[model samples]
Target: MLTKKNSFSILAIGAVVASSLVLFINSTKKQESALPPARPNIIFIFSDDHTAQAISAYGSKLTKTPNIDRIAKEGAILHTNVVTNSICGPSRATLLTGKYSHLNGYKLNEKVFDVNQPVFPEELQKNGYQTAWVGKMHLGSLPNGFDYLNVLPGQGHYYNPDFINSKNETVRYPGYVTNVVTKLSIDWLNQRDTSKPFFLVVGHKATHREWLPDAPDLGAYDNVNFPLPPTFYDDYTGREAAKDQDMTIDKTMRLKEDLKVHADYEKSGIFNRFTPEQKKPFYDYYENKISKEFDAKKLTGKALVEWKYQRYIKDYLSTARSLDRNIGELLDHLDKSGLAKNTVVIYASDQGFYMGEHGWFDKRFIYEESLKTPFVIRYPGVIKPGTQINELISNIDWAPTLLNLTGTTIPRGVQGESFLPLLTGKKVAWRKEAYYHYYEYPQPHHVYPHFGIRTDRYTLARFYEVKDFWELYDLKNDPQEMHNLYGSKGYEAITADLKAKLKKEIIHYKDDEALKIMESKL
Candidate 1:
């Protein structure tokens, strides 16, 4: 309806409008660039062999962990935090890959971690995260997917330990292992490029096997007497697996090597690692004082078992003292440095430990004590203060949850789901049970290999590889799991249901070998 000149004029006006749109977009982008980044920094503090019963937040009458309690006080505490495997190396591997041990190829302590595999940390680094790991990383080799890494070399020493740095050089640091790890972590935070968000993992070797306390904390728990577990002298009445475990406090714990009895195992190289000044105080206390008293008592049988329990608990708690103290120190640093509000602080262990539960010390079972790990998290803006989560969570779910929190894309093939909704108090449906598998047997601890599923009120396990048997427990009725109800007449429906659920989980996890085994049994 218009003339040629009018059409030309309209086209010119359209060009101007397009040009203005481009300018507006550019201005918006510039404004976005001027705004501060929103991704929160994460500081994950991990300890080795620390049990929930040891933390005061989890109700420990033996010791109080005020510093470790801060994370829960300020954020949320997860009651049912569980791991796929209850060992050290495999647990770390699961946290890294977000996959089950069978898929990740690090099923046991003997297996070397396949470093070529994709890990969540690598994904985080690609998404503008400055990732670092300090202290114990017992994954069989130098770790991948970390910008800064200084880790212990194979079950690192508690005193004067050697750290393998990113350059693959072994550097020996003076002082207690806990202190050295803390100092190095702080140093990294100070030197890190602060423009980018960071994912700093601080690992501690405190409270591991051969619990060695720092010199200053040698007699910290001397005044307190810890009560022996009710099942300390368990006769293993109806359970076959409980009868064969070799990690009992009375039978396996070495007085000379593990308890610091001051007997000369010069070849053990434990005391040789210390200077004479260091050795002098150790002998003065253990040999001159404690050993003399032990000789005087001449305890036997149940009395001997009770005595061993006390000594073991005291030494174990003393080591944990430094760990808790250093945690407080790190939190204070975060606060003073103005990084607390934006930092997502987390506290957990490699796996839960056995504080003499079931007459055992090491964890390799699907039982409640060894299966449950402590997990507390604090995100100033995201998590409400003093929140306690009863949702079921697994270590395999850790990577996906962390990635989801940072707004990063979780790579495919991850086995875990994000629990961020649980923290935010959302009404989203969450997992009802946790899957578990333990492969180590006949070495270190003589626990048989087993796999199981733990629902909110029940646990059903199958001990395979050596024997064919099924164990089931109604957790509500028998919280201690003293009774096994695998083939009782009344439990036909529950047993069948559990078996089916476990079979489905096995298939969902792509554990083909487990699936075949389960199918054959069915």
Candidate 2:
């Protein structure tokens, strides 16, 4: 059986067999490596002062937002989602760091954000994500965590607004702010690195103060007269903080500056922000026509207040219409680009606005209208369509939730736990009450700074800084917070329990100023 030719042939055949085995292993390895990562791309659409009352999915009858509602129709809606500060900058700061405003140190809009701090986007960037923010990142300093940024300076104008680019340069983009913001977001999606996952924030300045609609959207709700909220003339009899505030729809909402009386708000400089194309139509309808009619009627007191309410509600809803339309554009873009299947879309606001509740207009209180924010999210595979989560969610929990969504371990020192489980209807342990704090006051709205706690059925708060007063309400009984039960004879035990909870919450958040308020409770 042994021969030189036979031996050589056997050796060659064995070598060929070994080579084939190696090739197959290498091919399998290549295939496995070529698979896409499990992490989903995130599109966070954040709007300024867009209340759930205006969102039709949240059961608003005044206006219908088909596109924004589409997100809820197909995804999940959060009923008790709230913000830590209920203002633009602090809410954003909390969202970025997954921590309280005190931890982030951007407690109020007046402060500059410390860019050196670790943020969620920076963590995402480190983990191979391409992060960007398109519009209205109102934190005072330039954004540092994102790979790219085109943010609006300060509050941002409705038309021809200036955007601060990644290079610390402000560039003016001429268009309605909503449309321009959406365009930039789409443009970024087109140009972003396709191999890596992306996180894009399409921040909108719509439905904010002055409530200027797009030129095309003006007079949208002219036919419908929005009914006044039953509590529109809140006498503030029981709540002292409510009486001390100045953000009323009638008294504080300026006619020349806010309602656009003569279309020449040069002192506010909003009219100058508008070009001729915008000014001409705006003047013809709002100034020349509506103002003339308003003067002809000579309405006073309650009638005048009612007129402002109608005008205010119409313009606000009209601006919201444009916002929803642009949201539609982004949703469609996701669908056509094949990104929707693997991406997560979220719609939320910095905070909720009054929408004429309690005759007030601005945020900066721990009341339900101002404290709560709307949140709707869509994930093709993970979230089943039309899920509603009534579990309480705070803005501070945002970053940890994103990290958890990507299957990453949430970083240390992050205060908020991931709420991803809530989306799945898991019966997981969650917080019982939401803690709130507001520092900005005396300048803009004159609403006193306060810290408080909101439970499932009760709201307990302390209005501090100039005076000290405790407020308590059983939300089940007085859902509008019309009755303050503090110092009442029968509810001392309930008030004591809430105060204990508030102290724990303040310490948990590590807020030094609020700790003093908590100590004073003793």
Candidate 3:
């Protein structure tokens, strides 16, 4: 008995009510699942030649690295390691592209990295992330795809270093390289776009070859006599290939050439320019020591070699101490700015360094000392604090991980897998083994070109060019890698399996250039 007008009005009211209800429900659902505010900023503090064994968080008994240790304490420490190419420039290239050295076209220090290729930073920038790189980007070519860059040219000097800015202008700064680089990094962080997320890379030049510390850190480790590594005096007797090498710390280390120490008679009156007040510290630290050791006893032969090792270790640790302090400053900035809660902090080195292990001082070997890089990451919301992952990860994995964190798609042709699952304690299976190749042969260090595969239980390496030999080791038994079991009686099956795996990896990674080189020599 309702009229037509009344019926129409009633139907309109019902429709309006249903629409309002649906809108409210949709709004609530969106509010609940909005992707947690787009993720936190990322800060990567990368150092040159810093070893995993040098960090206290990694169980180093020799030196204390509280600041570097904080990253592990706050985040996850990757235990099983990866390094595609172990040299400086090549390793860096791998880090940026998630590809091997040959794939990235950066094989050695003498070779230049092509910047036109797609790098990780470029992907981040495309995804609305502000990226900046400060300090020693030791890539052979200048950095590209960064919103801002302040990098040093090859093997940058410790004092008054030259920095290339975004405008491609090379300018010299008048201070210790480490301090200046840190200051620049902090300044960039302060002035970055706060509305958008940022990715900052702070590269430090501490703990490289000919280790030099800042003035304040000069006598830091003087009182501490570092314990000699068990293999500090290894004669390389059983290994003919290792014995013929010229990288021994004792025999190859020099007094005047390598150490840069001289007696009073040999002093070229460089200190004469300084006042007595300025001269006091230098003489007190150097003169007495040089006179007592070099002038009086004339440290040479085995005695001189031991002295060099002691000096090298002390200076290297001292430099690392300064790097730790500066890292604390960056961390403090994040905490004060309320950025710590949402920021991802990562600390890593270009490659591992040898600290008198196997009686050597420099890198460029597929050996354990030179192959294992230090990697630590901290993400407050997504990652659990103090998490440790034992999965094998390579430097190439860094790019894909960063891309995944930013909700960006990783491009094809990159060889690394995203490690975000491992970061969050997710039980996802990753690569069980890692592949490494070193290409700088007959150059510096004279280490032959080699490629190898490292599994959880063993390592198999094949050196080419001059020495066509295969070396295998049970990493569980010989963690120091002292013995070679390539031709041993009991390990034939293990060796064959690892060699087959190595071949698969080489082909999978598309290391065609390496394959061609190796095949031609064979």
In angstroms, the error of model 2 at 113 is 0.8
Give the distance in Å from residue 507's predicted Cα in candidate 2 to where it truly belongs.
1.7
lDDT of each: 0.89, 0.89, 0.81
- C-alpha root-mean-square deviation, candidate 2: 3.5
Q: Which runs in model 2 stand beyond 4 Å of their true positions? A: 1-37, 265-268
Q: Over the stretch 4-83, how does candidate 3's per-residue lDDT look in tens digits?
A: 99999999999999999999999999988975566578999989999988899889987999988898998999887768
Model 2 gets an lDDT of 0.89
Clashing pairs in 1: none
What TM-score number comes out for model 1? 0.93
Decide which is better by lDDT, 2 or 3: 2
Comparing 1 and 3 on lDDT, the stronger one: 1
Looking at candidate 3, the ten consecutive residues that score lowest on lDDT are 263-272
Per-residue lDDT of model 2, residues 84-181, tens digit only: 88888899888888888878889778578898888888778878889999999888887577889999988899989999999999899998999999
lDDT of 1 at 350: 83
What's the TM-score of every candidate structure?
Answer: 0.93, 0.93, 0.91
Quote the lDDT for 415 in model 3: 85
